[model samples]
Target: MKPLLSICCTSYNHENYIKETLDGFLMQKTNFPIEILIHDDASTDRSAEIIKEYAQKDGRIITILQTENQYSKKIKPWPNFLFPMAKGKYLALCEGDDYWIDPLKLQKQVDFLETHSDFNICFNASKIYIQDTNTFKEDPFRGKFPEILTIKDLARKNYIRTNTVVMRNNFTLPEWFNQLPFGDWPMYLIMIKDNKVKYIDDVMGVYRIHSEGVWSGKDKAKMIEMTLIGLDMLIKSNILPAHINKILLKRYRKYAFKAQKEKFRGYLKNR
Candidate 1:
C-alpha cells in the first residue's frame, strides 16, 4: 500500500542526534501509513549505523547508505535522490539534527492539507535550540502572519520552517533547482506558486542552531547573498507574478545594501 505521507530525511555526521530524529518519526500517531526514506550522505560517523538500527525496528523505514558524499559533489538529496523515491500524497522534510516535539506534528499538518484543497503547503512554528548557548528560541515567524499566505507575503519573508512543513506532492521539481546553494526556500517558493499557504500556530519541532550546520554557520551577509541568488533564479524561471517580481527586486536591493554595509564594517574592523 502506498503511504499517505513520505518523509525524506538526509543525514551527514549526525551520530549524536540521529536516534532522536528517528524516534520522532516512529512516535507519530497517525491513521495512515508513512514511509521514512532516509539517505546518509556517506557519513563518516555512526549515523548510518543508527539509521539501520531504527530501520530494523520499524518496517516503515527505507534507507540508502551512500559510499560517497553526494553533497560534496554538489548533488542534492531531495530533488535528485530521496524525492524521486517518495510515493506519497504528501511529503515532509526533517534533517538528522532536528526532532519533532509533538508526535501529532505529522498528524496535524496532514489533517490540514487533507481538508484544505486550495492550500498546497501547511507549516507550523518550531523552537530553535541554540546549541552554543544551550537555550531555546521561539520561531521568528511565530504569530507573525495571518492564517493564509500568498506569494507576495512569502516574497516578503520565509515563514515556513522546513521541519514543520507538510506539502502536497503534486508538482515535479524543476531541473534548475540543482544549481542553487540551498533547496528548501526555492522549493517552498516553487511549490506555493498558484496556491495558498496555510500556517499552523502549533510548535511541532526543534531546529538545532549549531556551528557545524550549513546555513547556521554562515554570516548574515553571505546568507543574504545566497537568498538573492535563489531569487534571481526564480525571476529567470518566469514563474513568479509581476508583483512578486517587483517585490523580489526590491528585496535584493535592500539585502544587497545590507551586505555592502556589513562588508564595509568588516573591512574597518580588520584595519
Candidate 2:
C-alpha cells in the first residue's frame, strides 16, 4: 500500500529522546500506510546510532545519517532539502526532540485533510512543556482559526505550532522561508498567503523546552533581531504598511530588549 503520509523528522543530539519520538510514530493508530524520513544531522552524541537502531527494526522508517555536521554552514537546509524526498501526498513533521502525545494524531489530521480537499494545511494546538518545572505552560492560542488566515493575522500573532502542523506539499516553499528568523513562522506565513489553512483545535503534541533546544537557548536580543528581520520582510511584502510595521516592530523590539538584558544579567550572575 502507498503511504498516505510522510513524516520528516530532523534529529541532532537527541539520543535520550529519539526512542520516545520514534515510539510515538510507531503507535499511530492509522490504517493508512505511513513512512518516516529520519534525518540525523551529524549528531555528535549517540542520536545517529539510536535512529539507525529503530530503522533497523521498523520497515516504515527510513534513516539518513550524515557524516558531517551541517549546522555550521551559513545556509539553512531543513525541510527545504528534505521535503523533496518525502513520498507521501501530505507531510507530517515530528522533530527528533519532540514526540506526539496522541496516537490518533496522524489519523485525525489525515482524515481532515483527505476529506477537506480545499484546505492546504491543518494544525492543532500543542502543549508547551518547560523542562525546568516539567509542567505544561498555558497556551492561549490553542483553537481553530477561520478557514483562511490573512497576513495581518499572521503578523499580529503566530499561533501555529511546528509539531502540530500538517501541510500539503503541493506548493514549492517560498525562497524567503529559509532566511526568515524562525523556521515555522515563515512557512506558516507562506501557506497563509498562498493557501487555506485550517486549525484542528486540539493539543495533541508536546514541544519539549530544554537548555539545549535552539528556540529555548536563543537570547532575547538575538530573538528580537530575528523578529525585526521578520518584520522587515512583512513590510517589504506589503503585508503591513510602513506605519503599522513601525509601531508593531517597536512594541516587539522593547520586549525583545528586556529579554536580552535579563538573559545577560543571568549570565553575569552565573559568571
Candidate 3:
C-alpha cells in the first residue's frame, strides 16, 4: 500500500541524536501508513551506522547513505535526491538532530490537512533546546501565530519552524532553489504563493540549537548575507506579488544594515 505521508529527514554527524529522531518517527500513531525517508550525508561519526541498525529493524524506514559527502560536493539533497524518491501525498520534515515530542504529531497534522483543503501547509509550535546552555526555551515563532499565512507575511520574516512543517507534495523545485545557500524560508515562500499556511499552536516538536547546526553555527555576517541573497533571488524570480516583493525589499535593506554592522564590529575587534 502507498504511504499517505513521507517524513523526510536529512542528517550529517548526528549520531548522538539520530536515535531519538528515529524513535520519534516510530512512535507516531497514525491510521495511514507513513514512510520514513532519511539521507545520511556521509558522516565521519557513527550516524550512518546507527541509521543502518534502525533500517534493519523497520520496513517503513528508507535510507540514502551516501558514499562521499554530498553537501561538500554541492549536492542539494531535497530536489536532487529525497523529493524524487518521496511517494507520499503530504511531506513532513524533521532533521535528525530534532525529535517530535508529541506521539500524535503526525496524526493531528494529517487530520487538519485532510479536513482543510484550503490550507497547503500545517505546522505546530516547537520547543528550542539550546545545547550549549543546556536550557529549553519556547519557540520564538509560536505565540500569536495567525491561522492563515500569506506570501507577504512569509516575505517579511520566516516564522515557521522547519522541523514543525508539513506541506502537500504537489510542487516542483525551481532551478534557483538549488543555488540558494539556505532552504526553509524560500521554500515556504514558494509553497504559500497560491495556497494558505496554517499554524497548529501546539508544541509538538523540539528544534535543537547546537554549535554544529548549519544556521545556528553561522556568524551574524554570513547569516545576514545569505538572507539578503535569498531575498534577492525571490525578487528576481518574479514569482511573488508586487506587494510581497516590496516587503521583501524592505527586509533585504534591514539585513543589509545588519551585515554592515557586523563588518564594522569585526573591524573594531581586529584593530
Candidate 4:
C-alpha cells in the first residue's frame, strides 16, 4: 500500500539519540500508513547499527546505510537520496537527534493539509532543548505566529521549525539546492514560493541543541556568512520578487551588524 505520508530523516553519529528519534516515529497513531525513510550518512559511531535494529523489527522502517559520508562528498543526502525514495503525498522532516513529542502530530498535520487544499505546508511549534545548559526554550511561535504565512513572511525570518513541518511532496527541488550548506530555510523558501503556509499552535516536537549540531554549534560569524551566501543564491535565482529581495537585503544587513558587534565585544574583552 502506498503511504499517505513519508517521514524523511537524516543523521550522522547520533547513536545516543537515534533510539528516541525512532521511538517517536513508531509511537505515532495515524489513520493512514506512513513510511519512514532514514539515511545514515556513514556514521562513524553506532547510529547505523541502531537504525538497523529498528528496521529489522518494523516493515515500515526503511534505511540507507552509506559506507562513505555523503556530506563529506558535498552531496545533499535528503534531496539526492532520501527524497527520491519517499513515495508519499506529504513529507515530514526530523533529524535523527530530534524527537516528536506528540503522537498525533502526523494525524493533525495531514488532516489540516487534506482539508485545506490551498495550503501546501503545515508546521507546528517546537521546543528547543539546549544540551549544554540543560534547559528548554519555547518556540518562537509558541503564542505569536500568524494563522497563515506567505513567502514574504518567511523571507523576513524563518519561524517554521524543520522538525514540525509536513509539506506537499510534488515539487522538484531546485538545482542550486545541492550547493547549499544548510537545508531547512532554503527548502521552506522554495516550497512556499507559490503556495500558502499554515501554522499549528500546538508544540509537537523537540529540537535538540548540542555542540555536535551544525548550525547551533558553529561560531556566530560563520553562521552569518553561510546564511548570507544562501540568501544571495536565492536572490540571484530570480524566482522571488524584487520586493522580497529588498526584505532579504534588510535582514542581511542586520546579521552583518550583529556579527560586527560580536567581534567588537571579543576585541574589547581581550584588551
Candidate 5:
C-alpha cells in the first residue's frame, strides 16, 4: 500500500530505547496508511539488530542499516537520505528516545491538515520526560498558542516540539541543511516559509530529556550556542526572504546577548 504518511526516525546507539520507540510506531491508530522509516546511522550497539528484528516482522518498516557511521563525517541521515525516499504525503518525526502516548496522535493531525489546504504542518503538546529527575512534565509552552502559526510567528523563536510534528512531505531542504547543528528548527522554518501550521491542543507524546539525548542532553551554554549558530547559518544562506531575515536577525541579537550573560555567569562561578 502506498503510505499516506511516513514516520521518520533516526537511531544511533539507542539499543536501550529503540524497542519502546518501535512500539510507539506500532501503536499508532490512523485511518490512513503509514510507513515507518528507520535510518540507523551505523550504531556500534545492538540497535541495528533490534531494527532488523522489527523490520522482519512488519512489512511497513523500511530500515536502512548502515555499516559505517555517517554523522561522524558530518552527514545527516534525514535530509540526505530518508526524507526524499518517503512514500507518504506527510512526514512525522519521532526520535528513538521518544514515544507517543496518544494512539490517535496521527489521526488528529491528519484530519486537520486534510481539511485545511493552506496549512503545511501540524503539531501538538508533548510531555517532557526528564530522566535525571524521573519526572514527566507538561511542555514548557503549554500556555495558549495561536491555532495557526506562520514563519512570522516562529522567526522570533522555535518552541515547537519536534516529536509532535507532522508536516507535509512536499518541501525540499537545502543541501546546506546538513551543516546546521540542529535540523528541526530550520527544517520547519522552510516548511512554513509561505505556509502556516496548525497547533493541536492536546498532549500526545513524550520527549525524553536524558543525558544520552543528542541535543537535549547538552549543557545550557552549548544548546544556546547551537541555536545561535543555526540562526546565523540560516540568515547567511539567505534561504528566507529579506523580511524574514530581519526577524531572524533580531532573534540572533537576542540570543547573542543571552550567550554573553551565560559567559559572564561562567566567569563569575570560576572566580
Candidate 6:
C-alpha cells in the first residue's frame, strides 16, 4: 500500500541533532505506513554520514545528498525541486535540528485531515527548546488558539514549526520561493492563500534553537535588507490582507533595529 504521509527532512550541518530527529520519525506509532525522505544539504560535518547510517538500518528511510552545497551562501528552492520526489498524499516536514516528541503526531494529524476536508494543512504547537543551555523557551506564535486559522493568521510569524506541519501538496512554488526572506513563511502563505489551516493546539514537537542556526547568525544589516525585500514581494503578490502586511512590516522594522544594535555592539567589542 502507498504510504499515507511523507516526512521531508532538510538538513545542513546538524550532526549533533539529526539523530534525535531521525529517532523521532522512527519512533512514530502509526497504524498506516509512512516514508522518510531525508535530504542533506551538503554539510561539511558528519550529517550525511549519519543519515546514511540510519538509512542502512531502516528500509523506509531514503537519503538524498547534494553533489555540491545547494544552500550555503544563499537559499535554494527546496520544495520546488524536492516536492516532485515526494510519494505520499500528505507532505510533512522536519528540520534536522528538531524532533517530534509525540509518537502519535502523524497519526493524529492524518486522521484530522482525512476527516476535515476543508483543511489544506494541519499542524500543532511546539515547544522551542534551546540546546546549549537546555532551557525551554516559549514561541508566542505557538500559543493556544482557535481550532483553525485563516490565511490572515498564517501571515503572522510562522506559528507552526516546520516539523509540526502536514500539508496537502496542492500548490507548488516557482524557483523563487527558496529565495524568499523566510522559507516557512512564504510556503505557509502559499498553502493558506485559498484554504484555511487546521490547528491541533497540542505541543507535539520540539524546535531546537542554537547559535549556528540560519536565523542565529550575527548579520543584522543583511537580515533587514532581506526582510524589506520580502515585504516588497508580498506587497506585489497581493495574496494576503492589507492589515497583515502592515503588521508584518512593523514587526520587521522592530527586528531590524534590534539586530542592528546587537551587531554594532558586537563589532565595537571585537574592534
Could you estimate the TM-score for every candidate? 0.96, 0.82, 0.97, 0.95, 0.96, 0.86
Model 1 lDDT at residue 129: 94
In candidate 4, stretches whose alpha carbon ends up further than 4 angstroms from where it belongs are 263-271
What would the per-residue lDDT of candidate 3 be over residues 1-271, giving only the tens digit for each residue? 9999999999999999999999989999999999999999999999999999999999999999998988876677888888999999999998889999899999999999999888889998899999899999987767655867877677777888888999999888787788888888888887776778888888999999998998887877888888888888888898878888899888888888888889899999999
Q: In the order shown, what is each candidate's alpha-carbon RMSD?
A: 1.2, 3.9, 1.1, 1.6, 1.3, 3.1
The residue-level lDDT of candidate 4 at 154 comes to 87
Best by lDDT: 5
Every candidate's lDDT: 0.88, 0.75, 0.89, 0.89, 0.89, 0.80
- Where model 6 places Cα greater than 4 Å from the true spot, the runs are 73-77, 217-223, 239-271
Q: After superposition, which runs of candidate 3 have C-alpha atoms over 4 Å from their true positions? A: none
For residues 173-231, write the lDDT of model 6, one tens digit per residue: 75666667768767788767667889888888998888887764536676666766776
- Model 1 lDDT on a 0 to 1 scale: 0.88
TM-score of candidate 4 on Cα atoms, chains taken together: 0.95
Instruction: Give per-residue CA lDDT, model 4, range 144-236, as digits (tens).
Output: 558798888888988877788899997778778888878888788777767789998888899998989977778877887888778777778
Clashing pairs in 1: none
Write the number of the candidate with greater lDDT, choosing between 1 and 2. 1
Candidate 5 global lDDT: 0.89
lDDT of 5 by residue, 160-209 (tens): 88789998888898888888998988888887868788889899888888
TM-score, structure 3 vs. true: 0.97
Best by TM-score: 3
Clashing pairs in 4: none
Q: How far is 126's C-alpha from truth in model 5 (Å)?
A: 0.5
